[model samples]
Target: MKLSYYLLCFFLVFTSCKKTKTDLTKITAKTIAIDSTITSAAAIDSMVAPYKEKLAAEMQEILSYTAKDLVKNDGDMQSSLGNLMADMTFDMANPIFKEITNKSIDFALFNYGGIRATIPKGNITKASAFKLMPFENELVVVELTGKKINELIHYFIKNKKAHPLSKSISLIINDNKYDLKIHGDTFDETKNYTVLTSDYLQSGGDKMVFFKDPVKLTKLDYKVRDAIIHYLKKVDTIQTTIDNRVILK
Candidate 1:
């Protein structure tokens, strides 16, 4: 009787294990066209209407005016939009950075791809600023030695993209040679310079690894977007141009 009972229990366990196993089946998908005529549900629209109203109000708030369009371009040098962004980032953050560390930043550097949208000529709104810089990248200062600064220049020459640089520096790329000026002075190989940039680039965003291993790192606990917004609010007009700051031959 005991042997018969044990045999029945073993059979029950085996059946349970088999029941848990699933068989793989080949399934095919049928392509379906989207319904272009579909409308939003009334209930869903009603629920979202208030939030949409608030968003519209905030986005429409005028911050400043632009006399001309500022756009990001793939030129050999920097674009108007790039210059504006880099210069504003430095201008707004310089005081805060100086207050914190008692050292003013030399210049600001940013990627051209960072400007997501162009500013139309006329009123500049909060929405436009947000469109330009959608990321919440914070402001950071990296203190680099003269050697690393040279690397920064070389990287700029190799990558001929219109990476935004503040007017505090000047760069002229003539064929294989480059002339770099920091703070209106010629590039000094013995001096250490403090550079202001987004935290994203400080950690090697856009493959800017020259910013790594800095002599010092300072976080102003401020967002670059906020700095832009602040500058726009204070300035009545936004003016930036592509001049000798970045030259390519």
Candidate 2:
């Protein structure tokens, strides 16, 4: 009789503890106007003031100088700024890649849209680098087959936009056919070329699908903005030109 009483109590407790499902009944939304009506907290502002001042000083720190303005729209196939960007990226990221893999990056490429701002004919500061590459894109190396490299060339030609390419590559488009060279060597389909680019592009950003699914992919954990800053510090003056890196005939 005691055991039966205990079982009944246990059943009652279990039924009482059972959870019931809740259903969504109504939804509401409101638009808050953020005009001058909202006042910032004095404590919050005080806490952020020091950090803001420090960042401002660091951003304005001069790193290098440029004689002429470096703009991305200077050329149809290649721009002075684009060339500099590619070259500096290669120069900065190549050593890291080589140290890690004991292999050199064949070339560097970046989209035209990636050049967010141009360097004016004056001092180049840390702020300049940040402005040029505002995104937190890291440097990455992707070893692609020669076929994919060919497709990349075709894409550049089709777009006719100033896509930054390192000096290691020379592409001359003739009608539908093109002549390509890497590191002063004729194009070789049998060999794989390792390209240095931003992680964004490696993931096929800007419709550069050719960069996706490479033979090998390695992230150097280096930001493009940092690379630009480092390069600026190393060089006293920025020297770049629109060479025969890409040509259409």
Candidate 3:
């Protein structure tokens, strides 16, 4: 009887240990599967392979094309590329502002940081724009008082960097003073004006607190880079020139 009791106790303990091991194995297997799902280089590569191939092919085509007309017109590839982006800045902002706000915007401000590179002359392709503006930044409209608009201009000029302006904006910079003109009209401090800019600037990325204090803000679903790409596709023929919208001298 004693031997039989001992045997039964041993059998119970053995079974419990086996069950615990099985549970642990299952938990470890599940953890490994979850980790593999996200970190698997092969899976990621498979998903991105097609896009990579397409971009490579497009870039190759652009490189092969000669810019006979552009060269004859004394146009460089980088200038043309800058014009493409600058033009898109206006094209995308004007119509969208009319559609959403029903009020025409005074001008659009694009951050200098947003422009990655000059579009090379010749065959400008979608892939080239991607390389130029890699970030997936979207367009945003911020309504600010005329005072804030002057402040924004001062910030841009003080930095001495290039920022895209959609409409006619002139800044007369003197010793610690700036005279700003928008569309041939003097800026009114009491009057409200809508300015189209990127979400990045609105978020105070470039020390632009004016947008942060905007009376109204709207975000568009369109990415700025993607907008440029779409614009390029629509207008196959591109002219490269310096608009000098942001003049240093």
Candidate 4:
């Protein structure tokens, strides 16, 4: 009887110590939707009100004056607003670039999409600039070859939008062929040209593939909006007009 009890206890202990070989139960997560409406807390609003008011006041401060209305229109080869934006970028950025690299920017180019709003006649303020340029793009010089210039002309003809180009450049689409002149001189294939544009173009923005790999890339590290603001202030009155910068027959 004693031997039988010991054997039964050993059996019980062995069964208890044996590990189970069963598979783990799978877990599936289910989503429970919650209400998405958000309400502002008064404590947060009170903390932000003062800074917001100051920003609004600063944005409305007058920077300069406009002699006439500057509007951007599609299908037009040149627009007052486009010319002003491109010229101002060149004027403001080239000098600083020259000061650093001792080389001047041949011309400036910006996409029409970059112009977000229009400027009416009379007081030009920080608000107007902010509305015009909302992006914090930096000014850069892209040194492209003459072949690249031809590519740029072809690009213009293909798109046919009033992309901002400086006065120094004159592009005429003749017989579906590109006829372009830079700085009042015929393009020289053997020579290199310096173009002023935003780093956006440098990174292949707006399908500007030619600017992707330029001979040299120089950054002014100045925001384009800041350049426009400074240019507006430097020039007491803005008298930019639509010239025949781009003409097609």
Best by lDDT: 2
Backbone steric clashes in candidate 4, count:
0
* TM value for model 1: 0.84
Model 1 clash number: 0
Task: Give the TM-score of each candidate.
Answer: 0.84, 0.86, 0.68, 0.82
Candidate 1 lDDT over 1-249, as tens digits, reads 999999999999998878565787898989977696778899999999999999999999999998887887734578888988999989999999889888889998888778899999999999998998999999999999999988988888888788899999888888868888888889998999999998899999999999987999999999989999999999998878877788776
- Order of quality (lDDT): 2, 1, 4, 3
Clashing pairs in 3: 77-121, 80-240, 81-119
Which runs of model 1 end up more than 4 angstroms from their true locations?
1-22, 26-47, 74-76
Overall lDDT per candidate, in order of appearance? 0.89, 0.94, 0.67, 0.88
User: Can you write out model 2's per-residue Cα lDDT over 1-249, one digit (the tens) per residue?
Assistant: 999999999999999999999999999999999898899999999999999999999999999999999999988689999999999999999999999999999999999999999899999999999999999999999999989988998898888899999999988889768999999999999889999999999898999999999999999999999999999999998899889988878
- Error in Å for residue 69 of model 4: 2.8
lDDT of model number 3? 0.67
Worst 10 residues of 4 by lDDT: 32-41
Each model's total of backbone clashes: 0, 0, 3, 0
Q: What is the lDDT of residue 45 in candidate 1?
A: 96
lDDT of 2: 0.94
